[model samples]
Target: MHTTEHHWITTPITADILRGALDLEHTEHGVLPHRLPARARAQCVDGQLAMAESQPSGVRLVFRTRATAVELDTLPTKRVYVGVPPRPEGVYDLLVDGRPAGRAGVTGGNTLTIDLTTGTAEHQAGPVGTLRFTDLPDSVKNVEIWLPHNETTELVALRTDAPIEPAPDGDRKVWLHHGSSISHGSDAASPTATWPALAATLGGVALINLGLGGSALLDPFTARAMRDTPADLISLKVGINLVNADLMRLRAFTPAVHGFLDTIREGHPAAPLLVVSPILCPIHEDTPGPGAFDLGALSTGKLRFRATGDPAERAAGKLTLNVIQEELARIVEQRADEDPNLHYLDGRELYGQADSAELPLPDQLHPDAATHRRIGERFAELAFTADGPFTDRSA
Candidate 1:
């Protein structure tokens, strides 16, 4: 709170230091983060795509500063679902020297109201918000200000009591990941607490998370984006979005998965590409989708999802979790003969039958904060270890 000897300096948010965001556009107020590139975004006009890419899940501001006090001015679009419990304020997690230092939330920002019944949303303007942290160690340290995962944040200003510079890349491999809302930090506590974020921390890698909510269908544009993004490791968590969206049948699904991987291979032929299946979601395990809101739970002020399609639809080539898993495993196994770097990870290994009994999905879809932590830990152990798919091969 004390500004008396604070030699405040505004740092330029260049692409070199910003993590998790695919693109950044300067605005009248500041810079806006976009999880998808402009070209890719231009190819889609859906509302879900707009919201998901702008939500900034896994995005963070990284730099090295000797300043002990820091203040960041931002304009966050906080979403509120009417008739249900209000979501918590977006959290800003601060890390110094790769360790947790503090956590805070912005007080004022834009608000987005959603009507579940009609699937419509309204935006309301609000004043800019600020996040401040003080009492940091006086010595030079690597500082990471992780933005809100659930809120769309516009970076207005970043001020520190001393000069700052881009943090040195400590030889960390970049991990490019693509998945659905669950991977986008849906119900997680904060941006850094997302499973991918946590896994990045444990694996000692930088992350470029392309986890778009409701938009993870096997689009060519998304595959192209992944192909062009520089990465030492790549992963795709496929299935849930496809099933919940009812986007394709078994016939289209097979070729689509192959095309998606083929596109990525065009860019990096030898990069470790791990294909992950969906985690357990009882609603869509045997049943098909398009997933619908559980009206019964909504009436009591809760948000829950249910699969609306009949289980018998599988005979007609309709996709379900079980079907997708089998196909993904087969696809990966068949590809691994020629593409030795390719691997398959059954998502159930992260959160499956036994674990679900104790830590069930609160919304009947996405995992909670505790599950996010569990998944992150499991992923780190399984994928980054010496025998895992992402093990370093440079001997």
Candidate 2:
């Protein structure tokens, strides 16, 4: 009989741990970058740079992995996704140990297909299957994977020849996240280029992005989802969406925040959790939000600045970014006495007045690719690199 040692496995994704791991760097060079024979509505006038699949290229992906054995009968599995969501049209090709396994993924269906050539196991996305080639020759060394781009979003994780190391024994770890569209990479650049994707690249962790563009209002379902998932590293980037979506009022906010945290604790008893407030938004910088501006054409009248009164209403409705930041400090300080892993990271510190002054975001709603890069660098420095978050690789 075969034996399974269940060697420890490390998450290959180094990008965002929020919604999906946005693999921008790969998408730019892969299938989607090919700019398909089609055109996608651009997110910005300049175009979706960091996350958009503008120019597509045929690039091979390399997955450096070590395999493990199974006790018996239970086949192993590995799953690769287009990581970058809000994906446009694109094509992905898969290869194993240099063998052309085949390709799949459609703009309409959001699915994937694989041809083993050997026809071992068939996988698709819409039908959303996994392509598996088993009973190997046993001489495999490196796994080479590839995904071409489309005209929409970028690639997430390219298909792989090597599967994720067979799950280890004991407990499995997960990465949990919650945030706004920014965390969802709303209008940044490419699929893989979002800030979350960039940060994940450096973090080398599992991900579960809960970045609802207009929806992150600390909903119960969201809290339940977090509470249900088994996580190793958990983070919640609140405020931005609550402010942008104009979703809640402070009267209902404080309890919502506490309840959100409480819900997650149900699943992750002592997991490392981080709470981040919004980054600086000059439109709402000190002005408080539900920020808004009259984009209507100047009525050929005076050049006076128009006020929508929405920003004020939004601000009054919920906590200001600074307010959340301060409250987060208090929450963590109070919780720190009981939970050593609970941490608070100010979004401003990630992208605040200083960063805005240094390199501003494009639409005031989203950070530019350069800014994303900067944020990635800082996140690595503050959270991941050296002896930081990776400390609990045991997860």
Candidate 3:
């Protein structure tokens, strides 16, 4: 009887092999990729920002290999609500030469259970899980593994049947985008299915997504991070988070937006910068927020959100979607005379009343998977093609 030996080579997870993350931290178990740098993280002690930035929405491992089989060990922190149904397992997507080739999900890891009613969380420990991909073509190809967009993952180990090297950088323009939960892949089917990821593929640009769920509040630290990051194209999806969090009134919002843009300009003086407003969300268009969970929907075992502030509050300087869109347009127009590269796009063009009728937001907040695809397609058509703001001029 003849037996064949299967040789496995282990590789360390390093910054050179990773894309999209601004920094990498060595943990006791493995390496954790962070969208924001340590300095920015230390500036604010908010729990929401910490969790959202660590989820790795657009982060991925890119390498050149001929390996037919590959394995990755990860420790994922999964979120679970106390009363609502558990979310589906986080997915890891494999791309071969920029095409989706395979998909898998990790089984066991840590669980973070949160009680919305009490605003408390309990963490339960679990074991590390391995994601295995096999039957890939033996020819040399560029391979990319996109981590879960919604789950915080720590890369523990990487093993392959053949030696691999970091993929060489190409001439693709890097696109840096920032937004709210919708941009964070709240209900997207998978990591690459997120709107920004899809649009990046279509636009032929590298992506660095800084979409922090419930946390895009025009913070100075976040703007500083974006200012320092190198990029050819940049976009800021503002309005939703600011409205929902009720962090500020119009008195503070306009100047805050100006300061944010000023900081980004300090670093990227000539990069094409596009400012996007919030999509048409009927629940919050006229009414102001301070959004809250719908108590009635809790009985259905699903989570839903509703605006709590009164429509009359708008008279008192309370911010709403309508108020934000008007202000953003004015701000962008006012600044465009001096900054030729700066532009604006109304979010209604991406998703408006007509779109909501066709594809309603499942959670009354986040768009479903299909909506994500639609929004991505629309964005690619408007911004990446023709005379749109993000169109590649050098080409």
Off by over 4 Å in 1: 1-5
Write the residue-wise lDDT of candidate 1 on 71-158 in tens digits.
9999999899989999999999999998999999998889999999988999999999889999999999999999888789999999
Worst 10 residues of 1 by lDDT: 1-10
Q: List model 2 lDDT by residue over 1-395, tens digit each.
A: 98433433334333221122222334322222221112211222322232222322222334434432111110111222221223333444444444445454433323333221222333443312233233334443444333322223333333333354322222323556677666655544443445655575556554445554545567675676677655678888888666644556677777888888888888888888888777777665444555443333223221112222344454455556656677767877887888777778777777877888888665557676688677766765667765664355554
Task: Report the C-alpha displacement of residue 272, candidate 3, in angstroms.
Answer: 0.5
Native-to-model Cα distance after best TM-score fit, residue 155 in candidate 2, in Å = 14
Clash list (residue pairs), candidate 3: none
Estimate candidate 3's alpha-carbon lDDT, on a 0 to 1 scale: 0.94
Q: Summarize candidate 3's per-residue lDDT along 1-395 as a digit string, tens digits.
A: 96434478999999989999999999999999999999999999999999999999999999999998899999999999978988999999999999999999998999999988788989999999999998899899999999999999999999999999999979999999999998898899999999999999999999999999999999999999999999999999999988888899999999999999999999999999999999989899988999998878987787999999999999999999999999999999999999999999999999998999999998898999999999999998989999988887777
lDDT of each: 0.93, 0.50, 0.94
Structural similarity to truth (TM-score) of each candidate: 0.98, 0.57, 0.98
Candidate 3 clash figure, as a count: 0
Runs off by more than 4 Å, candidate 2: 1-173, 292-294, 297-307, 310-318, 386-390, 393-395
